[model samples]
Target: MEKIKRIEPFHLRKDREYEPFLQFILKILKEIDPIFHFENTVVSEDRIDKPYVSLKTIKKIGTTNQGIEIIIEELYEQVAYDIAIERIIVRPYGLNVDLKIEIESTRDTTDQPYLELRLIGDEIVNNYILKLFTQQFQQIPLDNEKLKRELLILNTMIKRRQWYTVETRAKAILDNFPEHPQALLALAIARAAQGDLEKGEFYLSKVLEYQPENCDALYNLGVIYEQRAEYQKAMRLLQKSLVLKPKNHVVLWKLGQVKEAIGEIRDALNAYQEAMKTTPNPESKIFTSTDFRKEAKEAIQRLMK
Candidate 1:
């Protein structure tokens, strides 16, 4: 039996939007079959009518004495295809969004895993990466504690690419988790995204002070320097990060850029090719978002000619 690890009963508020102070960590629980089912659950052993996502499972979000209607979609190669929820099921289970996941084993090879992430109580539901619930309403939120929900919402906003909202949420997170590395990184990225590299640099530098060799922080800082045309500084940092995360696609891509900028076409081409060869962790969902993967391929093609 699937035990309730945690339960922040769902609440419904239409037209409810996101807040900037929230952050989220997408986690995968169990893997199921790829033939999508709503009322059916996909579990380890085949059972009667087990769907990965369904109205029964989704109704939990609206179980707070209300009903909700939302749409779920499959994103194929940057194109989003929608799955409409014609009506809200008022049953005890929950759903109504595009948060889905698929079995990742090579034996179950599908073109891509149509994963959806949803934040359920403290023990996140291993679902819904699309959005996080907020508590602007009177009812108890997806999580009883407002702060946790805020973090979830913030992460969702970041995934959605809402920069202004991310900056606001990042500030909120920093105010509370003062030394939280990820929160600091989020804020720095938010600032850099909005064209304020100096502020971004300051926050990232702070992160490095706490965990000096953090590859993500190091890589991001290096990118910031690259943006500022400080090639030597950027090169030094990127090289340091590569030492830690030798196969990191983003790091290798940045190295390609830095080398190209320094008039080292041959070295740049080699770096891009190396980037193309790196394999990312499928569960982290970083591969899809790493545009440099495609860029690296294109760059190699261009350079070879």
Candidate 2:
């Protein structure tokens, strides 16, 4: 069984929208032969006869009184679906607009997962549902807390090497925040990590469009250029990043490599020596088995010959 889960936020006017939203989701899941399970067992059923259940049966679901909670499972013989809806009061006048949806899917694949599959891929299903939801309701304009959570999810995906998932999450953020720097940065990292250097470079350029002085974007783009053997471009970007953060040993090391690549032995040696002398930042997210300082020192020695 292959399972994927995502927690996504939405913006609806009030608790009243929860039932309609639930109906919308149920309509989509109907394509997959879904069974609904409600917290209020009185309304739970093996099959839902009416497309939209009567409000009397699901009273005050998203309100502070009852909170919208439902679980749907047994999707066909090969798939299982689960949806959890939640809302929080984060505004004044009892006018709450925050809604969070947690969707989980588990699929049991036969020998021919794609060819013989009755439903579409899980990722496609999620994207389709989210896209339709945004059109049916409102796309959430993320609050600061929501933004932090979104970025945290991207970071975790990157650490786990889930590049495609990172792309989806980043694109979801961009749907709400078109010029969000961190979202663009995440897309850049995801594209680059997936070996799509051209797309990665484009996304990094977008990041720079919003945050011209973003050191991480500059450094990453410089590394990409270096990989492409665009030494001059790499040197320019790395030098700009170094000016912004003179003590960044990783940037210095990268700059050294660029200079070395361009046959500027003296400049390369200077950069490497600087990298060797600079103290590593304890808070840096870059992790490597080799000591960068030792690597820089070795580069200097190699260049001295």
The numbered model that scores best in lDDT is: 2
lDDT string, candidate 2, 78-174, tens digits: 1222111212211111112222233322222111001011222455565565666556554456777887898888877776777655776777678
After TM-score superposition, the amount by which residue 274's alpha carbon in candidate 2 deviates from its true location, in angstroms, is 1.5
Tens digits of per-residue lDDT, candidate 1, 68-143, equal 2222221222222222121111211232332332211110112111112233332234322222312221233232
- Evaluated against the true structure, the overall lDDT of model 2 is 0.60
TM-score of 2: 0.54
What is the C-alpha local distance difference test score of each model? Answer: 0.53, 0.60
- Could you estimate the TM-score for every candidate? 0.51, 0.54
